[model samples]
Target chain A: MGHYWQEISALTMRWVRRLSREKFSMLFTLVQPMLFWLIFFGNLFQRAADTQVMQAPNYISFLAAGVVVMTVLNNGLAGGVDLLFDKENGFLERLMSTPIHRTSVILSRFIFVMAITSMQVLVILGVAYLFGVQPATGILGVAMILLIGMMFGVGLTAISMAMAFSVKSHGDFFSVLGFLSLPMIFLSSALVPLTAMPGWMSVLAQFNPMTWAIDAVRPLILSGWTEALPHVGMVVLVMIVFDALCLYGGAKAFRRAMG
Target chain B: MDRTIAIDVSHLSKTYDSYRAVDDLSFQVYAGEIFGLLGPNGAGKSTTLRTLITLLHPTSGTATVMGHDTVRDADKVRTLIGYVPQERAIDRFLTGREHLQLLGALYHLTKEEAAKRIAELLKLVELEAHADRPAKTYSGGMKRKLDIACGLLPDPKVLFLDEPTLGLDVQSRLRIWEYVRMLKARGMTIVMTTNYLDEADQLCDRLAIIDGGKIKTLGSPVELKIALGGDIVSLTLKETGRISSLESDLTGRPAIKTVRATPKGLDIRVESPEKALPAILESANRLGCNIEFIQYNRPRLDDVFIAHTGRAITESIPESETV
Candidate 1:
């Protein structure tokens, strides 16, 4: 466990170094999703107030849960790209050649990416707060939302890393980003309520881990976690399943890649 | 067992499909020695190094670094060895100090140890002035220097430098050579690979002439040159089409040991270039082939490459093997 912590700290240091240089570019990745939240959530909730879909006074508060989840998910999925890039650049080769444990390299990325997601959620939430979006609950609710988001991020990142090794994508950064981001955002409850969707879509939302994460934190952020245990439990269950599947995929892909 | 051997490999082999990249290749690099792998492209120089660094597992064989097994004990071996790859591995986003410190932490150094080592490495690579600058802003030489510093972070026992001066200017290349020598002076064991004949000649204490996944010969560079018999007097046929045919005309000459035509010209390595040049000139005119130029110089590592692999080192790599 101490070794694991060492790897995590080292990995976080590398990310900070990398992000620190592309200082302005990182803002683009962090801010672009929030902009979507503002433009889509602010206008959509205003239109939905007359409809039966939005029961809350300000739908943007309900929307904050989704924004937090999506931000964490996208960041986590792309966090896998860090490992992919290292593989491409021969950094992984350099590391592998050293005395460092193979598992440490993979674990470090997982820990660091989760940390980064935590920070990113804070930044996004701060922005949302400025737009008059506030969680009705205290610090614990916010921490629960971020923790659940981190869990989802880990699962998504594992899968992306698996894909990165199995198939080499030639598309540039934004192309890959656009290819992955929109489908995931639409499929989950990030944009609309699960009940607002058709019966089939609600079933899909139940299976979508993003939907579980949003539903887990939405009531907690708007009403409080005392009322959101069921959603939180569901999210936790989905995360465990997804984490296992993704870790399996990542490990298999890693064997094939390292060979 | 006493750390006398910096590297030891027994029956090391790696194969890709029917093509064998390294075929039961084996050799040893002793402590505080600058050992060289001398070969042309496709001679499996990189493959051998990759295996030692635990980047690739040997298909069959045992490789140990500083008495640590490269395969079964890869994690421990990884911490003990510093590998400088053929290509650059610096992260452009990080400054020199940050990059070294990050990698230092990965090696599990304490905070104070990491800081001290980062400062020491930056100074060792002569990048102390540029330590705080982002690597993206560094010049090619500066980047390479910083990269070498990053490799030295853990105070590794055995350092693997694969083609260190590959694409740099002459001055920077020499600078790298000087640094490697300095490391050796400090009692660091180093293994280096190079296709350049002169680099190996100037630096390697002992070298293995690798070709076609096999070690054709291994010895000190001077001894290898002497074993290669003195000088190479190469004949360039005026007509390129007849280059291959010239070999048949000059096959049984007493002065010439071997004759072959490469992309460069007709290369002939022989025992006595003084006698072979006169006979070669007489034979070329007799065969109705005009000689463009005939130059005789002492046998270089390039001739050793040709003698071993029958291939030139500088020929562009095929598209599939570009990386």
Candidate 2:
């Protein structure tokens, strides 16, 4: 068990170090969503500051949580790109040839993705704070935001990794990414509130896991724990179920791949 | 030398959907000897190796590494073997030292033990000076050396090297040969695969030449060469018209066993090139076929392959097709 933990940490550090070495890419991944919220969405919804439709003092504050979750969504969903490349380059084959604990490979990937997701969440929140959008739950709100990101991120990362093995090539994986990325983002309340969306789309958002995460996070940033904690608890439950299913399938796919 | 078998793969078969990659393959690699799987691309060399290494499950059959069944006791087999895959597996971001340490940790080596072993391996592969640099900066040879070091980190009893020197230059290939020799000296059992005939000829103590998912022949290089019975006497005819008559004349001679015609010449296998030379020339002269060129050569692994398969082991497959 001790050896297992050490191997996991070692492999996790490998991913972390690889990401850190590419400073520009790491920074870009964290900053891309923040840029969208601050420059594009912030200006696009500048008039929403005077509107009562938004629950915050400024649109950026309301959009802040959404941007944080988006980072998690994008980064976590694309986490398996590394796995795909590793498989293609035969690096994964080499790793499997060793006598080490096999689960450590997938576990370390999850840890690495979560670690990056956490950093991206921080960056988006920090950038939003710089734009004068303060979370009503304060520093504790930052923790809540991270919790929301991770809860949502783990399930997505697991599915991504699973798909990385199940799919035939990068083209197939990218198509799935393309097909799912927009729907998950737009179908959720990332760019708009459920009330603002049409009746049919709003109904769809209700079932989208992204909506539950955004709904859970929005209250902490805009309203407070009074509104957020209940949703957070519910999202945690949903994520537990979601992660169990995804990780089980991911492990199955991983075993087939190793064989 | 321990004559005990380090690896015994019996009637191993691996199939993928409709394609059978390996078929009823049986071979034993003795401990501390460098055994080669000689074959062209797609001949199941990698599949057989993968099955033994537990990377791929065999559709049917059993392989034992140091007496542990590969399928049932895969973990035990893994602990006893290290594999250097055909493809280069080094991460570009990690320095050579980091790669070695990471593998060491995977094998559950202590930090002190990993460090000491990494130092020793770095020296063994002659990459000590470049061990701290990122592997991406190293030349092709350095990357391959680091890969070998990674495989050796566990100090396994058997090491599987799949096409270890495939894309290396002559000098780098020779350097790897030295490393292989050194490993053999230290009593490590090594199994390597290659499509290069000369590589198998020079490196392996014994080789199994696989073609079309079966071992065409298996023996030491010298033994296989000797199995061909005699030297190959090649004669280039000036005119192609009388070649058939000359071939018939040589075929009837007691000294010649087989005759084959190439685009440039005719090759006649004889028990003794020196003894058969006079009869071969006399037969050609009697048939009025002018001999443009004549040469006597020892039988090679290639000849052995041609003898069994009726075709030369061609080396013209481009790299892209290998994937």
Candidate 3:
């Protein structure tokens, strides 16, 4: 329990794999995004080609990158709501009585949720690959992008968990998720690029963490890492800062939850 | 607080602005005893348990388990104790075997060790027949057994059970009681908290009767009953309204120290009901109160509780404390 990274990783792995075995939520996490990629983006892209002033590239690839970020954000955003069920069942109290490492308990959950989301991203990419699209970067870039994306995902996860600890039941967490998730996704570059949105929306996107992640990964996926350094550095910096801050907030919130 | 005891709690109080959930509570659970903390709902039993278990920080005091401070050495405490929380905690999606194995692995058991422990716990809770089925498919009793199995996965030295058989069927409750007895025989120290009075009466070695965040009394059941002073007389009244007026009239009578209206009839607490019966009958004949049924029985825990708290054991209900 003292140095819990390995144990946390193992636990996280188990939880993530367990998600695949679960039905309702797992379906939402894995398949729902795929449908969004196909239907919503497909409809919008059909009309984008007719705009004579600007070129809309292969809309599917454009949408796939968004799906990756969306998956991470969605996964991160949903992490703590599950704890509500744990509270209801009394498992949270049971775990607290154990001699397990506290850090492992917190970090392992984030690692696991993000890990499952990463698998979902892979599935999206796999299907995207079948449609004649390729990641502009190779395995290394994809892995690094994922790593960064995951770290940011952890930050968002911390925020959600912090919120969950303050709420009494799962019902409250579900409603709060809407208030947190939609704004972050919309304000970020999930559905469209910053330039494509209205002026005020672009300005709002500038401050959005999801927008930062989307900008960081889109170039890496669309044109590979060789195309930008400053952009990548900015996203990485934002992710790390938020990751540290949110974790601290989460730990504080978790400690308070016991009261 | 000395940091050497297996479980030490001191002046622990928690307040929610105005609610005052737990107030200056203190207790110690040593190495090996099936200690029961008995109380009614919202008597802060689970809050006290949670604070000792290191799930919550005390607003004022401190608790240490296994010679490690709950606040400073929570991870160590987590490694040392197995807790069966009050609410039934189980993932319906996971199989019994898988859930046990997953929990075992979390405790850093080698795959072999995890499997072995899982196997033992499954059989111990009598879930060996359905080890491979998902917990969702389980009956409430089966799920409850599996929940207990999950707690046993780590083989903890001190087991903390918070209402282990709550909401279980009679048969399942019997089986779980048997399992709990077996656990105690293995020399494990268990600290059990229950709002249900009977569970404590049946399962505990020694009980602490808690009310309104304070220990009202602590002793073996027999000792507590004996200390309550005398045998009880219960009587059913032909009519309840006839007794109250005559109760005060009988109190100063030869054999009567006090008179109480019981569900059975008008009961007279006395030194000798048999010797004083004719005098009581003469007095009652003057007052004209008829009795339906009557019996003399030994005092029970509920009576003891009433004597001390001046309230019925079953009343004054508060919400189930969500730990």
The sequence of per-residue lDDT tens digits that candidate 1 reaches over residues B164-223 is 988899999999999999999999999999988899989999999887688998998777
lDDT by residue (A1-259, candidate 1, tens digit) is 6765776677667877677678797788777877877546665666555434744557677677888888887887687777767777777787666555567777777777788788878887788788777776778778887878878888887877776666565255446767878777787787688778788877876777788888888787777767788888887988999889988988999888886
Which docking category, incorrect, acceptable, medium or high, applies to candidate 3?
medium
Backbone steric clashes in candidate 1, count: 4
Itemize residue pairs with steric clashes in candidate 1: A98-B78, A98-B79, A99-B78, A99-B79
Task: Please give, for every candidate in the order listed, the TM-score of chain B alone compared with the true chain B.
Answer: 0.77, 0.81, 0.77
Model 2, span A108-209: residue lDDT tens: 998999988897778777787788877889898888789878878888998899999999999999999999998988999887888888999999999888
Fnat across every predicted model, in order: 0.79, 0.83, 0.68
Candidate maximizing DockQ:
2
TM-score of each: 0.82, 0.88, 0.82
Candidate 1 - chain A - TM: 0.89
Q: What are the runs in model 2 whose C-alpha is more than 4 Å off?
A: A48-50, B233-294, B315-323
Q: Score the docking of each candidate (DockQ).
A: 0.56, 0.70, 0.51
lDDT accuracy of residue A164 in candidate 3:
77
- Per-residue lDDT tens digits of candidate 3, residues A71-135? 78878888876676766777666555555565666777776777777887788778777766588
- For the predicted complex of model 3, DockQ is 0.51
Model 3 chain A weakest 10-residue run by lDDT: A48-57
Model 3 misplaced regions, further than 4 Å: A1-6, A23-28, A38-40, A49-56, A137-141, A223-226, B1-8, B28-32, B64-68, B233-294, B317-323
Instruction: Report every candidate's CA lDDT.
Output: 0.80, 0.86, 0.75
